[model samples]
Target: MGDHQIVENAPTRAWVLHPDIRNFGGSGDERPRDPARALEEAVSLAHALPGLEVVGNEVVRLPKPHPGLLFGTGKIEELKARLEANKIELVLIDGPVSPVQQRNLEKAWGVKLLDRTGLILEIFSDRAATREGVLQVEMAALSYQRTRLVRAWTHLERQRGGLGFVGGPGETQIEADRRAIDEQLVRLRRQLAKVVKTRDLHRKARAKVPYPIVALVGYTNAGKSTLFNRLTGAEVMAKDMLFATLDPTMRRVKLPEGGPEVILSDTVGFISDLPTELVAAFRATLEEVLAANLIVHVRDISHPESEEQAADVRAILASLGVVEDTPQIEVWNKIDLLADPTARLNAAARSDDIVALSAITGQGMDDFLTEVSHRLTGLRTEEDMTLTFAQGKQRAWLHEQGVVESEEQIDEGFALTVKWTETQKRRFAAL
Candidate 1:
């Protein structure tokens, strides 16, 4: 019924991509870059996909990058052969291929060829269950499709009935449709601007409540939803799939030690080679991460490309001006899948700002919460302060707001000892 609620509809498919060109960026790590790892990651993403199956996959080794098609002629032939051999009807490229390249590749392969951008867009399109999310996806899709119109509307010599036909057959139906879609995109942008203003107003209202927003950001299918559900007790869509969530969901979560409730926001997950079009389109959604007071960088500890994916998320966040300066708690999720858990723990400990936890099994959740508590409250030591019944207001405030570490009955009056925030301490002092 609400945008926060998950939509239980839609069928999706996991298409295969040629592993040879699966490059997002250079990793400084000396570990060998395995393309099989990319394919495995892609399969993991498919697990979270509802009503979808990765029926097949294939990789094409091209001679070099061609300006128009990205792959050379001989490699294109090999690609065709592989597609036929594998009975694969759809191909996905894990790199940023231009619209021209996409069209040319599809023509050469004789099947749907989706570049990294296109695949991401398709996932975004399906994940966009809300009206605003749909608007954002549509805006991005239109921007992407505008350049590929030549493939879908090649026959431009049939215009006749339109009043603007004076411009000749070149000004055809397809061109008019493109113009109309452009106009619609303008309207959609305006509408989304209004929605953004509304979200801004809501954010300001939230600020008055004084809850720090801790956003979970990482590569897609990194168990962010599962972690969010575990922390908030909200049954969000959590599966072993990619891009399962497109809309940002926020919920109030209680701290382990009865501390102040914090706003935990689960945003749309990031990917290794995210499309620029989707990035620009979903900038409004990602603004949540930028505005958050704290960020939890959730990583799939079991993923082979976990380090690389972490780097990708970090790079994207830096590009968005959301760097390490913000209070960041790296959460290494899915530790249950690891054979040597302590090794993973040691790896996480190396970061000094990281917490190892398995969202599925509730392992290390307590330690993770403690780490978050330290980051948020900066509570170094527990203090026991005595207050008299004469300070009835202060006692009541402590009972209502602060966590009572200890209580005692003094000679003259009731002595209540409690733990409070720094601001709460200042308020208490003023009282």
Candidate 2:
């Protein structure tokens, strides 16, 4: 509500609930997430919001969601009594809740209610720092609010008088509010277009250089930011909380010898059932992953639901249109959390596409870096080229890339021997 509300002195008492559905009808072949782990994730999400004290959390097993209210009468009464006893000011549901259901539950429990989407939106609104990030979150929130206009505002039931020429009697307040939201969305889209154009120009400028982009992606709290900070030595916020890093961060990193320079990108973490509005709104920001030469998927190797979390991350990446050809490596992070040394060592030696490491304690970092360097070097190709005196820009670019091993001055121009990757060669050719 009102973008985000910040409480200064007192934190709001909140309770988290994760609805564990037994059967998903005829949906895709995806397995339902573990209930216990889902409850933990929900609690973490509640903790991510500032000034929210998560007093309690539980996994509520339901065969199917009730139409009028998400929970049955008995369950609702039980939870209402518990919430009253605990003095919870807010209830956070870890799954979708219909507008009618949400309203009914709120009335019954005598507290504010936030479904999964709303809670995620609040977190994004509070964490957004950059101008683009803020705009995207607002746009997404507006879109979500537009759909819930039926029960979102109390004034929606009021009718405004209008001239006979315009309408028979008048328009409802909800209609006017929807119109206003539409106008706001249009304005935001225009501003976002200009921002996107500027970002595209910046991307083109980066393309002139020979540095390859390596983007990190994974589920929330999977150690992507930690690994990014460790690799780039940047002070990006790296915490054990969900969605801690909302804005994408990029830094130029020099690889080991025989490896070309790379631009490392730390992106917002993905979560299971991320709102569709957010997915569409954040597409511009996620283009960094689309343009990447390599994607490193960081995973919390020690988590109980690590594989399930990995599946969720992969699903989101696929939804984002990540191509099959893009080289990907899975970093099994938080190996230090594993109690068994043999298991850690075995996980580290698993496969070519997998590298086990601990971003916090710096264990297995060398192996991770070595694998990255090896993969990047594998894309290199040596080439011989001649640049005429008229092609001063190309000559300068080749030299700037540090790819020119030898150069000779000819009568007409310069002859250079360059060992570069296919990407670098194409960029130089374009120049």
Candidate 3:
């Protein structure tokens, strides 16, 4: 029955375990996250993958992780009994599990095991839609699989040699596996390079039209896609699920009250402890966020771990080398889901740098748009200049941009007052 269970139809019964390791020493800020919240996040991740029936979840407290087996022997036996009674087929560990630990745990429990990174990769594999997204996910999965090849093959100690004429020193099975993975990675990289080139051409074409970019970035399921749909009237898939929007989507949106039009970009949501393989593979896709003229960080204000999620997003942005001075706004989303009305009202009264809104309810959307317009307008520079009759090309360019607020013919030329952004000014200068 277990062997014949269909992943799409039968839905594997899964158990989630989050190890609350005491004195878990690591670099950086020392404050540890709440274990309960961490466990809740793991459960949510389990739900993110379709056809995974989360049968049970719990926090396994440990002074430290065991080297071979992640949990103590007694705890392992206890969980094994519980899994048998519940008929759980899969176990998901909410943190890193070494290959040795994973192999030992699966042997002891008589069930398949997956760690946080593995689960995330599976979710990405299921969610990726575009050709580039599929390629990137496959590359990342291959990279991750390469690391787990030790657990994958029992004949790693075997060796193979070439034909007599070409034979040198024989290669071990593990070396052959690693070489194959590396070759596949090279091929994928070549294909990805071509796709990226085409995407770059598209970006160049957009730059010619040259609307300022406003990118939405946030933790998974933080309502970024919802807000993007509200602003742009786009039909992008927005769900209360993690990683709902995998590939970045862009649409031209006119700001509130007939303000300037800007390109709104909805990017893949960030997560805490995102897989290193995925981060490297998706760098090309994330370049959109880096090029944005403005970044809107959406936060799920109703979630208990919102602050932690925001920190994760910021840390990732920093790793991506987002300029410190890049224009950004904090959007407190899902306010309608907040339990306290008074608190929600207070949140809505926050400063311009922060705006509270309910993307699902369309509340405070106008205010959010107003804030966006105000922020973008602040980046513009207005100046007056003189152009001679011979400078007809420049005059026409200014009119084309609709930045020529006022123009008057003078004795030897035309005096013009123009309002434009730095990018627009640079483009005109190039012209």
lDDT of all the models against the reference? Answer: 0.74, 0.85, 0.84
Give the poorly placed runs of model 2, Cα more than 4 Å off: 1-8, 25-30, 155-171, 256-259, 385-420, 423-431
Candidate 3, residue 240: Cα displacement in angstroms equals 1.2
Off by over 4 Å in 3: 1-8, 27-29, 155-171, 347-350, 382-419, 423-431
* TM-score for each of the candidates: 0.75, 0.85, 0.84
Task: Write the residue-wise lDDT of candidate 3 on 351-390 in tens digits.
Answer: 6588888999998788888888988887777899999999
TM-score of 3: 0.84
Listed per model in order, the count of residue pairs whose N, CA or C atoms clash below 3 Å is 6, 0, 0
lDDT per residue (tens digit) for residues 1-431 in model 2:
35447666788999999988777554646677778988888899999999899999999988888889978899999999999999999999998888888878987987889999999999999998878899999999999888777666532222232323253324476799889999999999999889888988788778666677899999899999989999988989988789898887899999876677899999988888787877887776678998888899999988888888899889888988998777899999998888886776786586789998899999889888988998887876677778899999998877766677789999989988887777667788788
What are the per-model C-alpha RMSD values against the true structure? 8.7, 4.9, 5.5
Q: Is candidate 1 or candidate 3 better by lDDT?
A: 3
How far is 82's C-alpha from truth in model 3 (Å)? 0.9
Question: Candidate 3: which pairs clash?
Answer: none
TM-score of 1: 0.75
Residue-wise lDDT of candidate 1 within 1-431, one digit each (tens)? 24235446633344666546433344535453576776666655544434655676655444346889787777778767866776665676766677677767777776666666666777788788766788999999888888777655432222223344454436466689799889989999899989888887787667556566789999888899999999999998886667777888889988988665789989888876566777788876778898676799999888877888899899989988885557788899999999888988987788868899999999999989988877777732357776666888877766654345678888867755565455457656887
